[model samples]
Target: MARIAVIGAGMGAMAAAARLAVAGHRVTVYERSATYGGALGAFERDGFVFDTGPGLLHLPAVWRDLFLKTGKEPLERCVGLTEVDPASRHLFADGSAVTLPNASRAGIVSALESALGAGAGERWGDFLGRARDAWDRSRRPLLEEPLWDDWQVLGRDPYPALRQRRMLRTRQAATVTEVGALELADPRLAALFEGCALAYGLDPRRAPASAALLPYMEQTFGSWYVAGGMRELARAVYERCLARKVEFGFGSEVTSIVVRDGRAAGVELAGGAVAEADHVVAGADTALAAGQELWEDGDVRPQGGPDAGQLPGRFAVLLGLSGARPASAVHRSVVHSPDTGAEAAAVFGGRLAERPTVTVLRPDDPRIRPDDAHEAVTLTATVTGHGGAVDWRDKALRERCAEALIDAAGTAVEDLRARALWHEILTPAETGAVPAPSLAGLGGRYLHPANSTRLPGLHLVGGHAHPGGGLAHAGMSGALVAGLIVEGADFRGSQ
Candidate 1:
């Protein structure tokens, strides 16, 4: 059995470690923090709990498959899983609203028609057809397998071109914004689609129309929530890793991947101790790892693009309210920015938005609160991920941004400000404080670094690697890495 050393206890890294150990390889995970689950963190205060990272899971089948492969108990048994019906509620800038049913295209079309207008439903339905085309064409290549050697093929936009006579002059909708303008042809509808992309940290203005797969994936597969906060999902995976005999070294920071004789030998710890291994799997930030000299000479450097040295981060506000949640509350609600074009300019080109689109999450689960008398709410918006550009250290600035988000969420919740007993602000300083996944869309390259690098015994997992960011994408990265190490580079994918 190969002795494998995994850097970072991120979900992706641990997922790979568990599978590799079950395959009979001896594996150990090293994390800088005292806990597992890198971005999947939880916060608690006075009996109130909040998910500091992703509040919901999309395409949960990725994790479901991981559970079945690594252990006998299915994912359902590990955690209390529930489908979030009326999947989401949308509040458009135009004062119109729609409630989308979970994974029901017909229901969504009807809701849009009733709320927006007659043709609106038809228009969205038509867009879904086109979106399905993109999903079918690219899903396997983008998710199931490792990024191909010639990943440039993915850079060629897969969004189908429209044949309308007036649109004939244009070859196709090149970017997601163009898709909204040319096809959807309504400001509200465009905002709806763009809002979804922004939540994933994609710049809707330049992101490929193929990014439609974001909403399409959610609508098709359905959105799910764990019994408690999303933190429970992370805990479940961590337990599975332990049961599989995968060792975890918390508070152990890796200084560098030890390279000997031109291959990854193991890892050098912060105190200068060395743990030898036959292979080293990295699930840390790709750019940071390279800067720390984790790779030998001529080994591939992961970050090279127009978006050099920058990854988008999230701004969040967690609220602990004094009142109990009303029965009408939906699991998630997105209040679209009043001026999306201007908001996009600020996020992709300038500073943070003065009035950004905000997503509010209020799970019905009672585990998040002290008692039935109290409630928990979380608000989030995507911002430029780098901490250097804007100083998140300023308390006044964080409060202003937090207030702006709370105001934007007013349409979804009543007396949003007064009802809060207290609130916590998590700026790019906190969310971006940790090295989260970089959304890959610079210069039309959707693919991140390949799992197999120039070094023979080194592999990369996590959102920084191929298939890119998000909880589901990170999980997929781990599967691809394990498949490569066990079956060799010739390994196509997991069976």
Candidate 2:
């Protein structure tokens, strides 16, 4: 049995550890933090709770498959997983609104048509049909398997754009922004189409038409909320790893990757102690940043800085409110910004929009709130990452941003400002980790580096690696890494 050394106790790392252990490998995970679940964290104060990371989970089959593979116990048995109905309620800037039903195409269309007008739903439904085509074309290579060696083929856009005659030449959408403008035809529908990309911190203007896969997946598969918090999902995975006899070294930070004879020999910890292993898998971005040379020249380098797969810093305003959450309120509501173009420029350009799009999450779970009489609300927005043009560290700036979000939430929640007993602002500086999902177009600018590295016995997993980020993608990443190690490079994917 190969002794595998994994870096980081993040979801991806833990997932890999569990699978490797089940495969009879002696896996030891080294974590820098005291806890698992890198971005999947929670905040608790005076009985009020909030998920510091993603509020809703899409593509839950990824985790369900993990549970099915790792243990006899299913995912539902571990967490109170339920589909969030009225998938999302969107509050447009023009005061129009619509609550889309969970995973029901007809329901979503009818609701959109009722709210926005007769043709609104039809246009969106048609767009979704096309988006479905995109999903079918890109699903396997992008999500279900390891990234292709000639990933350039995957770089070629899979989104089949409807060609239109413009003068003497036929035209098709190159970017999602164009797709919205040309096909959706209405500003609201356009916003709905673009919002999907923005939710992943990708600018719609630059995001490839293939990004249609994400929204299509969400509408078809449905969005879900964990009972306790997203952290519970992480807890379930960690427990599964322990169940498989995977060892963990919490508080033991990997200082460097120890290489001997041009192969990854093991990992050196923070205190100069070396743990020898047959293979090393990096499930966190820390390993990439901590050791750059491990990746030889021409390897898929994880880029940083503004606009280079560097996600906009998240500005989350967690509100502890005094009234019971209204039964009529949907679990998630997105209050759209009046101007998406300007908002995109501000957010991606290292500046903050005065009126940014805010996603308000009000979970019905009692565990997150003090009681039924009180409610816990989380308002999140994509702004400039910390140390950019906007200083999230500035208290006054943060307060102003919080106030702006409260103003936005007021559109969705009644008495939002007045109901708040207290408010806590989590800036990009505070919550450093943000979601980054892999997209399949724009010449593969959004695709992550391959899982296999230049050096033998070294593999990559997690958001920064192949298949990209997001909870579901991270799980898929772990499965892919485990497959590569267990079955060799010939492993195609999950059948």
Candidate 3:
């Protein structure tokens, strides 16, 4: 059995480690933070529990498969799954609200017809059908293939691959803003689509067409909130890894990928310690270690700034309220600002916008929260990278930016500030500088560039790689990397 070292304990790292261990490799995971779950994990503040990252759970089957592949059943280990109806409630600038339901094409059409208009539903149907087709085509080959070498897979059936490429190319033409214009008749609905772009630190005009699948996935497979908090899901995965006898080294940051003789030998930790392994899988941020400083012959290298070719960064305010608000919904409420594209463009151009799009998350999904306590809410806005000004050492600047984000979210936040039991604000700089390796944090590097260099045995497995970020895409990338490692082993055996 090969001795493998998986760097980073995020979902991708843990998933990769579990798969490797179950495949008969002795796997060890090294994490920089004191805890596990990387971006999918949580932390506690005051009496309230805050998910440091990833609040909603969608495409859970990918997670289920990860555990099951390692000989543990996800269903048996955690609370039974609960489907969230009306996937999300969107509030537009005009104050109109629309709730997307969990249903079939016919059901979605009927609902849209009633909410928007007769022809609105048909437009939605056509849009969703095309989106679903794109998903179906890309899910297996693109999402589930090692993005670094996806050309090999695409070469298998060139025609279909070419067709898929054509779809992607055209989809790029209708930026998120363009999609909003073409897809929705109601100004409120258009803003709702733009709000989705803001949720991920993207401008509606630049956001990929593939992102349309997010709403589709939520509506089809359903969104879920783990009981207690989203952290439960992370805890469950960690326990599964433990059960499989995977060793972990928390508070141990990997400093570099140590390659000897053109192959991955192991990794060097932050404190001059070297951990040797036959194979190394990097769950950490690839961009952090891909430059000339880390590996001399790495496959993926940084071509520009931290956000090069990546989605935008975000600033957030987490509020622990003393009382609940009626307007707050079960899952998420997105409020789109006017001129979302211009707002996003300004951020990307290194100027903070006067008005930013807002996305709010409530921890008290009635199914998860009990009847007596006040709810916890997180309000976030997209921000421009202040050229590494995110260092928390600049306390006053951080506070000012945090307040600005809260102000941008408007009156709901005014109520929050008045009654909030506890409040914590995080900027992209702060979130990006969480003591973990640069790229490992939630807002680390954005989507890596195509044709970039890659580390020897170290593979990029998260939103930082191709096909871009999001829970489903990240999980799929992890699965692809795991499969590649397994296949490589088989190839070695044949030799």
Candidate 4:
């Protein structure tokens, strides 16, 4: 059995620790914050609970698989899953709105057809079918298995093996902008699709085609809300880790990964206490880890094209309301500005725009929100730049930007302000201070092609890697990294 150390206690880290422990490795997790869930955590004030991150859960089968592998069933631990009707409500600038049904490809197509045109439904169906194909092909080899090091389990040339297994080629998937342009018949509808890409702090044009599978996953498998809040999922995962005897060190910030003799020895805490281990898995922000230059030989640098360092920071604003909006759906609601595409380009590509696209999530589902007296709302907007001296602390500028976002959402936000029991605005700078920086630049490296680097004995999960951000992808990333560690090969080499 290997003595393994997993850093960070976010969903990915927790999931990795549980799986490694179940596999008979002695595992311990170290978190820099007092809390365990990282972005999945929730904060409560005066009977109001707000999920600071990931308010909705999608592709629950993924979680079920993780639980099954760890000898714990997800259904048994928390509220069983419930399918959300009208998976999401899309409000366009043209004063038209459409409800996307959950898992009903035909229904969604019909809705699109009714709202857009006669052929819109069929076109969407075709697009979704392609996305499903991509998801099927990528899940096992790219998501489930490690990044190609474990030769015995993955065999040689996993990509060919995957191809033989019939996984879809990455090149074949639709780019974010392409999906927006093709799947939705209307330019306004297409703009709405582009807005979704911004959720991961990526521009539709720059985002990989493979990412189109994200919306597909939501439509096919459906988005879910755990009773009480999405944070419950984090709590349940933490419970599983505890059951597996995985030790957790909260409020313990790891300063560096100590490398000895070309191998991971362990990590040194912020105050300089060293914890030794046979193998170390860094669940922290990839950018932070890379910047520290901790790994042996390999550098945890950002990958991708020349303009990588210029990638913008991930930003959002969370709001809590006193009363529920009757028009607001139970699970998620998306309100877009007139020029969502332009707004998205500005946020992700480092351009500035006067208006920004916004998405609002309110869990009115009985299971997720038992407290009917009050409603919890999260409004997210992507922004560029690290939350440094210039951006975060500029009081006047920040307030102006925040107000602009609230105004762009239309009168619902005005109503919310009047009835709001409590609310807080979170900037990228605040998000960066979390266990694993949720914002783009501060946590991990920027989203660049050529600047990418890999380190020995350390792997990156979550928004920092190839597939980028989102709850499901991040969790799958942890599984993939662990699989790589067990298998023993470089990500590309495995393919």
Superposed model 1: Cα runs more than 4 Å off: 164-168, 286-301, 304-309, 433-444
Full-model lDDT for every candidate: 0.82, 0.86, 0.61, 0.62
TM-score per candidate: 0.95, 0.97, 0.81, 0.81
- Tens digits of per-residue lDDT, candidate 3, 1-495, equal 888888888776777777777888898999888988766655556556666666778778877777667774654466546666656655555555566666466777777777766687777777677667656755544555443332333222111111123445633224446566645545665565566656655555654555565556666777776776777777787887898889999989898877777667888998799999877777666543544333244233344433343335666778777665565454566666767767867666766666677777775454432234676778877666545423433678667766765665554344656776667876665455211111111122323432123345656555555435666556665666667677853321111
RMSD of each: 2.5, 1.7, 6.1, 6.8
lDDT of 2 by residue, 1-495 (tens): 999999998888888889999999999999998999888999998799999988899999999989999989999999999999989999998889989999999999999999999899998999899989988888899988887767777778888899988899988998888998888888888888777778787788888888888889999999999998999999999999999999988999887787888788899988899999899998765453344355555455677721474567788999999989998988999999888888888888888789988999999999999899999999999887787476788988999999999999999999998899999889889887455677777767888888888778888888777788778888899999999999996899976
Which candidate number has the best TM-score?
2
At residue 113, give the lDDT of candidate 1: 92
Clashes of 3: 8
lDDT accuracy of residue 73 in candidate 1? 97
Off by over 4 Å in 4: 148-175, 178-185, 285-301, 304-307, 310-314, 324-330, 349-352, 365-371, 388-390, 411-414, 433-456, 484-495
